[model samples]
Target: MSNSRSTKLHVAIFPCFAFGHITPYLQFSNKLAKRGHRVSFLLSKGAQAKVEHLNLYPNLIHFYPLLVPSVDRLPPGAEATSDVPFPLHGHLCIAIDQTLDQVQTVLSSLKPDFIFFDFSLWMPALAHQTGSKAIYYSVITPVAQALKVPSKQKPEDMTLEDFMQLPPGYPSSSVRIKSKDFETAQLKVVANDLGTGMSIYVRITSSMIWSDAMAFRTYHEVEGPYCDYLRKHYGKPVLLTGPVLPETPATKLLDEKWTNWLCNFKQGAVVYCAFGSQNKLQKDQFQELLLGFKLCRQPFLVALSTPDGCATIEEAFPEGFEESVKGRGWVYGGWVPQTLILEHPSIGCSVTHCGYGSMLMVEELKVAVEVEREDNGWISKESLSKAIISVMGEDSEIAGLVKYNHAKLKEELTSEGMQERYLGTFIQNLQGLLD
Candidate 1:
């Protein structure tokens, strides 16, 4: 169990198709590699290309590419969930399942001491076949994972209102939905049901039963009770890997235009809005978010991710809306260096989709004012305005609490803090299981 050079473990990591999941798995693999362990970080050929752009330890962490088969109504070479339209994601899952035989073959050949697999339900089977200890690494929040704890009644069988309620026997009411707030309940349910043959829930619960242990990309300080609930329900050792934070963009001056624009505002005067890479806002909802920032009359920098095959960002904006808010708003269509933006002095609060990876980074710096979505995943202009005001309001108590929690969480989740507290013991435990 010691971190001895002679006792190094060879670990294989297989994350789900999404970059959100893939990115963190890579971070963990790098951590393992830094500790003198060897890692075979496996992904689809397309996903391999995506990770290559990030920091990769070539000598210690090797890449193994799996070819994803084409699915019905899904285009060829679309291995990632983000590559396809929202409705066709089910087809992507079917394609992922088809790769199981190939994965089993590869795992058998590699014969790694352990297999760290993502949320794919079919994955543990490969680990089982290869006699490798299976570990489930969840990239989502603990609350979402808690809500997913297997229930007697299927989620599809219940009403949306009923579906919003936390399954019975959960240890806390903090995440429970007494009303129609499904955000606290099943924000991920839609994606879960989008799979073709096996439902996302079915895969999740099955893996919980099959896997030797479960790991979360979260820390106990933030969701300790929920973590405890998962341990009791799944009957396994649940490990917190701390928040696997993304590396900030290397350069401070990431973009000239955005940098100059952000400088115009006073300290803590701007609202930074971004709904992660995968979330594509509809035309109406997208306009409403823009208007919401205007309504608050706060200087803002917003990154609006255009839907697949949609018109350009300029066309998507409401007629004259951009010009009206021209002096105060800076709207962008695609990728931006978010960590650098958050670090800017004018940036005050954030309005986010609460994506696991985005929230992990956002929470480490400033208070995140999360906007709730409707059934169609749209937030009204009114709701958006209220959230912007609540977080950016100078004398707001809620804003203060959010900032305090961020400071506390940042202290606990720093790279050195995490490796010393959780990941070190996590490896020791895995070694114990191996022996």
Candidate 2:
């Protein structure tokens, strides 16, 4: 714990099973533990093992079991949305519903000072029953909260095009979804319930309603207006808890093969590309992206997430594709240590899904120039190549902006001291209740 004088409170965190959600919650748990607070990280049987392996704050944090109920179509050990196909996400939500009884029991017994949850809409009510303060710790942006569907509009009635249209109360016209990027079929399925009883949007709306306060995984400098909008829209206190930054592990040499591979490139020369865990690109789009990287002929490292039952990387790759880009690029299947890669000297830019976790890390480092796939959704081979070249090309303006913005954001995120200060305020606010 830092020497900062204060009170310590027990904080319980219940993150969804996905790595995107789990990583931030773990970081938040570490942050609270570092402040000399006891943290109970409630995990489903599936997520517990993976999280325990991370060896984060072993002494400060305690792990508790939350059962993931058996659901049809979902594999036995699967608890996270990332563990299954994107289409199966609703099933995971249904499985999460099973945890209600277990969570209530464990939480009531532990009776922590505060309980933090992600996407668990029932948590706030559970916290209330247990005499614990509840905070909805959102990993996604405030945009979801800013846009509210009219009472008359049912999600089932809305099409992908309808969803793409800007919702009421949107602060700007700049946030509309693009045609290519919108997954109509997949989203339509997710829009309706898969035995979860409530849709994902309903879960989000209800969580905000039942919580004591809302905590966002963003800062005022970047999304102040949206945060302000959310406060008014929800009629609740919204706390912009600085981007929950992950601490670099001390022993990151888990994979020496990639470590040696990355060191060969010049400083700020390699393009690091990874679309988060849950996003799945059709085979054609994946090939186009690969061809684009090959077209640029730059040194790059791309991590591709193969679908749930895909045979191998070879199955997904174009014939002879690996041989063609052998020296210039490396395409790996499954998990990549993004933070370690970003910290590498050879890393120059990242082409990512623009997931908040990835973006916040890139912004914090201010090192890698980011090219988000979500910016224009899907693009042709030529456009994809152009985007890569725009970032990698010598004397390109985009490269310059990447360098400048990285430094500026890094300074702002650190120097502003918002994360630490906001966390202190959060503790104080909760402490006041006890007083």
Off by over 4 Å in 2: 1-5, 148-164, 177-190, 251-254, 307-309, 355-378, 416-418, 433-435
Evaluated against the true structure, the overall lDDT of model 2 is 0.74
Per-residue lDDT of candidate 2, residues 1-435 (tens digit): 332346678888888878778878888888888788899988877678777756468898999977788889998788788777766777888888778898888898999988998788878888988989899888887755564442334443544455555666666555534454333443455356756777676676678777888888777777777788878766778886677677766765537887789888899889888888777778878887888888887888999887434677668887789899888899887788778788888987778765323333344434453444543456566766777787667898866776678788878777766678977876666676555
TM-score of 2: 0.87
User: CA shift at 189, candidate 1, in angstroms?
Assistant: 4.0
Query: In model 2, what are the clashing residue pairs, if there are any?
Result: 366-406
C-alpha lDDT (0 to 100) for residue 138 of candidate 1: 82
Estimated TM-score for each candidate: 0.87, 0.87
Best of the candidates, lDDT:
1
Which tens-of-lDDT digit does each residue in 7-35 have in candidate 1?
A: 88999988888887888888888777767
